[model samples]
Target: MRLQMHAVKFTADQSLLDFIQAKLDKLDTFHDRIISGEVFLRLEGADSNKVKEKIVEVRLMLPGKELFVKEHDKSFESATDRVMDVLKDKLVRFKQKRNDISSPAIAEAKTRVDEEDEVYEADEL
Candidate 1:
C-alpha cells in the first residue's frame, strides 16, 4: 500500500514518519486489499494549556470503500497510536462485513441440500 504523509504547519521527523509507516503496515494483515493510505498531521492552535492539540487524520482507500479516522494528542506519536487503533478496528469490521455478505447464501444452499437429503431418505423408507 502507498502511504502519503503530509504535515501541516510543521515538519515531521524521520522517526515519527517511520513509526507511522510501521503502524500502517500492520493493517495489511487484516485486509490486503488496501490500495493506499494518506496521513495528515496538523497542529491545532487551541488553548496553550491543553495537553492534546496535535491532530492526526488518516484516510484508507479500499476497493469499494474509504475509511477515515481522526485523533488528537499531546504529540504526534500519541495521535498516531490512537489512529492505528481505529484503523485496525475498521479493517476488522470491514472484513467481517464482507464475510457476512458472502456466507449467508452458501449457508442457505447447504441447508437446502440437507433438507433434500432428508426428504429422499424419507421417501426411500
Candidate 2:
C-alpha cells in the first residue's frame, strides 16, 4: 500500500515518517484490497499545563470504499496504535459485510434444503 504522510503545523523527522510508514504497511496483512492511504500527523499546541497532544488521522482507500480513523493522545505512537486498532476492527467488519452469505432469502433456502436432506436421511433409516 502507498501511504502519503502529511505533517501538520510541525516538521516530522525521518524516523517519525519511517515509523508511520512501517505502521501503515502492516495494514496489508489485515486487508489485501487496500490500494493506498493518507496519514495526517499534527502536534497540538501545548496546553496551560505544557501537555502536548498528538493527533493522528488515517485514511485507507479500498476498491470502492474508504475508511478513516482519528485519534489523539500524549504520544504519537499511542495515537497511531489507537487508530490502527479502530481501523482493524472496521476493516474486519467491512470484509465480513462484503462477504456475507447469510441474507434472509439465502438463509431460508438453506433451511429448506437442510430439512429436505434430513427427511431423506430419516426415510433411509
Candidate 3:
C-alpha cells in the first residue's frame, strides 16, 4: 500500500514518519486490496490556541470506498495509535460483511448440485 504523510505547518522528524509508516503497513494485512493511505498531522495552534491541540487524521483508500478517522491527543503518536486501532476494527468488520454477502448464493447452489449428484448416482446404481 502507498502511504502519504503530510505534516501541516511543521516538518515531521524522520523517526515519527517511520513510526507512522510502520503502523499503517499492518493495515494492508487486513485487506490487500487497499489502494493507498493518507495521514495528515496538523498542529492546531497557528492562532492563539491551547497546548494540547494536536490533531491526526488518517484516510484509507480502498477499491470502492474510503475510510477516515480523526483523533486529538497530547501527542501525535498516541493519536495515531488510537486511530489505527479504530481503522483496523472497521476494516476487519467490512471484510467480514463483504464475504458474508458474497457466499450465501454460492453455498445454496453448491447444496443443490450435491443433491442432484446424489440422485443421479442412486439411479445409476
Give the alpha carbon lDDT tens digit for every residue of 1-125 in model 1.
79999988667899999999998998999998999999998888744644348899999999999999999988889888999888889999998988784688878988898988764566687
Best by lDDT: 1
Q: After aligning candidate 1 to the native by TM-score, how far in Å is the CA of 32 from where it should be? A: 1.1
Could you tell me the TM-score of candidate 3?
A: 0.77
lDDT of 3 by residue, 11-81 (tens): 99999999989999999898888999999998877566555578999999987889999998888899889
- Which stretches in model 1 have alpha-carbon errors above 4 Å? 46-52, 101-125
Write the residue-wise lDDT of candidate 2 on 4-98 in tens digits. 99988668899988987888899888888999999999877744545479899999999889999999999888898899899989999998877
The C-alpha RMSD of each candidate to the native structure, in angstroms, is 5.0, 5.9, 3.7
Q: Give the TM-score of candidate 1.
A: 0.76
Any runs in candidate 2 off by more than 4 Å, and if so which? 46-51, 105-125
Order candidates by lDDT, high to low. Answer: 1, 3, 2
Least well predicted 10-residue stretch by lDDT in candidate 3: 44-53
